[model samples]
Target: MVDADQTFVIVGGGLAGARAAETLRAEGFSGRVILIGDERDHPYERPPLSKGYLTGKAERESVFVHEPAWYARSDIELHLGQPVTAVDRSRKTVTLGDGTTIQYDKLLLATGAEPRRLEIPGTELAGVHHLRRLAHADRLQGVLAALGRDNGHLVIAGAGWIGLEVAAAARGYGAEVTVVEPAPTPLHQVVGPELGQVFTDLHARHGVRFHFGARLTGITGQDGMVLAARTDDGEEHPAHAVLAAVGAAPRTALAESAGLALVDREHGGGIAVDASLRTSDPDVYAAGDVAAALHPLFRTRLRVEHWANALNGGPAAARAMLGREVSYDRVPYFFSDQYDLGLEYSGWAPPGSYDQVVLRGDVARREFIAFWLKDRRVLAGMNANVWDVTDTVQALIRSGEPVDPEALADPGTPLDTVLPRA
Candidate 1:
């Protein structure tokens, strides 16, 4: 058994790292916990960075998870602006950017993910941005402040959550926004085409131009100023600034160097962790976007890059590191705000596996709930401004009982009515 005062080193200071530290303290672990982060600021909410925070509706201080005093009170030793350069797993020590070494009884990796890059010309040009950190948000905020409702042109690549949120933020600045996505419909991968069509309609109503099925050819700039983005279809559009929201890849360099097993799928690269979020090495624990967790419900490997997952996975990883046998089987849920619409999605639908989809409300009003069914059982469901049934649907899906699609589609039918009594 390890001493209560044993030092615990946590890498990455985002939600995962912060949550792990907080959970450790809450669990009565009075150990020396050192959080190493490359960024200088305290852990802040990242979801708002692409929406309210970026649009200037929220201040930087408002997004911070905890004040400076909270970390001190919690006794979490924070080493800010210091990146971990190397990890000697054999020695059980990590070398920091400044060459400082810290020995750890246990290590929790929550490094998270980084924005994927577009390796074309003009990517390095001025006015090109990616929103992942507070610093990036600050920069974009400064740009919005500078433009000041002057009908500026903002070209954004990718139509994922971040891209759409950025578009909303840019539109709030009164800028002419155009989004380019390679998918046939925005959110095609997540919600499928039927719901994606509804999302597309909402954006179109708000004047967000989408260049669907458009391939990025290159970005071009003249004298350090971004001029336009060229599509593979041989079309060029003028823009004042370009934002690349092409999604993110797991930051697993440190994990790979430590000889951790990684599940390199066709989609991306991420360190592979078991049901309990443990790497091949038993002493090492990983969570958040960096660790690809296996979903027991789907009986397949899945990685969620959502705020809820990051917040919950961190503590779950900490628990595992603390020798607590627990399975991280929480139902995955995520929210996205764009164009005055709030979208809440829960659970998963394996590709083309859902046999039927039930809609609870009118799609034209932009408020509805769509449930995916497999063999008359609820597999997954999404709510658009209809979050009341989130808990009910979550329970029903996890109930492992077959649900009648007809009942789910009937708006007059209450969700609990269909649920089997406990």
Candidate 2:
């Protein structure tokens, strides 16, 4: 049971930490809440950093989860730019970078994740970058603006969502862009080949070039600035700037050092937690990217690095901390925007788990909904340029009822009507 006088310490002041603190207050927990972050800025949303903020379509101030004043008003202690160096579970306290030891009865680890840095040579060059924080996006934005229209070539190292989004934004700035991926198609691992081809075609139509089944061996530089990228295939791609969008790994050092159990590295390394988001230690909880929790719907452990998971998981963890009967059971969901294409995906179905993909609407025209099915049961679904059907898509996955492919493909059939009756 949580005592009202005990301090609740939250590490990692990102969206997850902010939301957790908000949940604590809303749940009537009058305990002292301290939110610690290594970054100097207030908690902010990262999705915009790759899209609107990088393209100059959104302001920097707008990305913050809440204004600085809100923390003070909420009576939540904000410890920005302070890294927690050690977690002493025995002492029930954490030591900060500044040598301050803070005691906590309940602790939440929301350490989030970091962008995977490239090990290739010339990564130290001035024009080489990676987008994970506001500062990185700001630097890339400046580099793009300086390049002007077709004045420079931007070579992207990976063809994942971040790579594709940055490619669209760079092209919008009139910079020639090229994307290289080890896979055969962009997002092939996530959305599968057919749907991935849709994105590949979309970028190709917008003047973005792609090099599939390729690996960036090293970066070549001229006078401390990146000039080109050398791939394993003996091709040198001209690059005025290079953005490494390879992917990210969860920040699990703190949790690991504290002796908390983590998921296997092969299955996405992060602190292991139950359905209620409680860690190996009942006094400690975890949420957001740092948590690999059991998903009741999937009947497996899943860790999502998307914005929606952080937005919902934090609150659920907080409620559980207060001894409320809660389970973080929402279907995993995420959305991305590139050029004119808008995408929303719900549920999880690993590659090869789904035997067939059912397509509704047009794929070539860049407007459609696609569902991944296993044994004629919906496992996951995604919509491109399609609006207001996410709820129905999620319901289908939750219902776990076998659905007919023909009804799903028919435009006249409303999505809600396709579900099995309760």
Worst 10 residues of 1 by lDDT: 143-152
lDDT of 2: 0.92
How does candidate 2 fare on TM-score?
0.98
Best by TM-score: 2
How do the residues 1-422 of candidate 2 rate in per-residue lDDT, one tens digit apiece?
A: 33448799999989999999999989899889999999998999889999899989999999999888999888899899999999999999999999999999999999999999999899999989999998898888988887755489999999999999999998888889999999999998899887888988899999999999889999999899888999999889999999999999999999999999999889988999999999999999999999999998899899999999999999999999889997789899999999999999998988989999999998888799999999999999999999999999999999999988899989889889899887
- The CA lDDT of each predicted structure is 0.85, 0.92
Clashing pairs in 2: none
Over 4 Å off in model 1, which ranges? 1-5
Error of 1 at 139 (Å): 0.9
Q: Against the true structure, what is every candidate's RMSD?
A: 1.9, 1.6
lDDT of 1 by residue, 1-422 (tens): 23556888999999999999989988978778999999998887798898788887777788887888998888889999999988888999999999999999899889999998888888888889999999999999877666546677888999888888887777777788788998999888788887788878877787889999996778888899888898988889888889998989899999989898998857446888888998888888888988888877767777888899998999999998888997888888888888768878888885698878889887889788898888888878888887677898788888878877777788889878877666
